[model samples]
Structures are given as C-alpha cells and as structure tokens.
Target: MQFKENQTIYLQIAERISDEILLGHYAIGARIPSVREYAALVEVNANTVMRSYEFLQTQGIIFNKRGIGFFVSPDAKHKIKEYRRNEFLKTELPRFFMQLYTLHIPMDEIDSMYREFINNLTSNPSNQES
Candidate 1:
C-alpha cells in the first residue's frame, strides 16, 4: 500500500485495516492476516504491523486470540465508523468548508453534486462498501 508522508505508517496501516473491515473484506469475527503475513503483503517490517495491530486492539477494532491470531471485534464496523466520522467532521470537513468558502462555492451546487454522487454509488453497487 502507498504510505502517506503526513501520517505515521502504523496509523496508516490501522486505518487501512479499519477500512477493510468496513468494506467487509474482513468481516466481524473473521481472522485477519497475521502480523508477519500482513507485513510481507504490505512490504513492511513485522514490528510495524505489530504496532498497527496493537493500536487496533486498543481501539476495540480487533482482539487477539492467545495462540491463534487476531480477529475483528464484533462492533468493529460501528467503532470504525464512529471514529472516522468524528475525525472527518473535526478535521477534513473543516478544511473542506474552508476551501468552499475561499472559492465562494455555493452549498446548493455541492449539494446537487453530492446527491448525484450518492445516486451513482447506489446504482453502482461495486463502488460502495458493505
């Protein structure tokens, strides 16, 4: 995966995993790839993936089985959505609003575009996450 320079790698990995969970790539209670496995898949060190897994565990997005592996928590989707929604509202939305204001963009224009996007998403099921 492409790593963003602005965020820590481990955090980015955590976000990717959360996104996968939301997309149903890793369903609730499903086992995720092992640390070493994921590290190899992402072309990163095992320790880095471990840190990402630890972060997810703390966030209640995943749980570790003593000898088996990690599995998605039952409420992982809800937790991921709650955390991401708040993050977007607190950071991204403000920046987006600032851009809109600076460009003197009308809300109605954005609203119409947003509605069209939603329509397309609904019509194109593959574009949406489960």
Candidate 2:
C-alpha cells in the first residue's frame, strides 16, 4: 500500500483492487469490503477509498448493492484485462521502446532477452506471484 509519488492515491488503490481481482483474490460477484473498512486496512482516508471505489464503478469493474457493499461486476476480469493491456501498451511500451532506442539496443537482442526472461519466469513458479 505504499503510495507512489507519480500517481494519485485513488488510482493506486483502484489498481491494487484490480490486481486482486485478477489474482482471484476477489471473485466476480463477490462483495468487497466497505470503503471505511478498506481504508482502515490500507491505512488511508475513507474518502480516498471511496474515490477509488467510484472509479472502479465508473469502469464497470464493480457495482454497488443497495443496503450492501460493492460487488465485483460479472465481466470485471475481462474488462480489467483489456484495460490493463491497453494501459501498458499506451504508457509502459513507449517508455520501454525509448529506453531500448536510447541504449542502442537492437530488436533481435531485445527479442532474445525477452525469451530468456519468459523462460526464467516459467521455470520459477514463485516468480508468477508478482
């Protein structure tokens, strides 16, 4: 729950929740903690957690139930994956390409390194946690 200076806290919170969902920690249609409860758990302001929840709701990742707390949307997994894939392509891929260009790294070298990295990841079960 460490806050990064580069992004807003609410966005970070939303990302964390999305990650949990992807990890199967939060199943589809499962109820999540209340805003105040999650704030307490993450040691943040309730309002901040509320903002995160609102963002998730707007993204169609979660829905609120009257008299009950929020539940994960039925298609949240698909939606989250699509959103994350697009986000990585839009933000991270550009930075990665820039780094490769600045370092004068060839595409073939990058491809080889990527393959090695993937092989290592697949060989090590613990590496999949992150």
By TM-score, the best candidate is 2
Looking at model 2, residue 44 earns an lDDT score of: 98
lDDT of 2 by residue, 1-130 (tens): 6889999999999999998999988888999999999999899999999999999998899999988999999999988988889899999999999999999999999899989999999999899754
- Quote the positional error of residue 33 for candidate 1 in Å: 2.0
RMSD of each: 2.8, 2.3
**Which candidate has the top score in lDDT?**
1
Q: For residues 1-130, could you state the per-residue lDDT of candidate 1 as single tens digits?
A: 9999999999999999998898889988999999999999999999999999999998899999999999999999888888889889999999999999999999999999999999999999999965
lDDT of 1 at 107: 100
Candidate 1 has a TM-score of 0.75
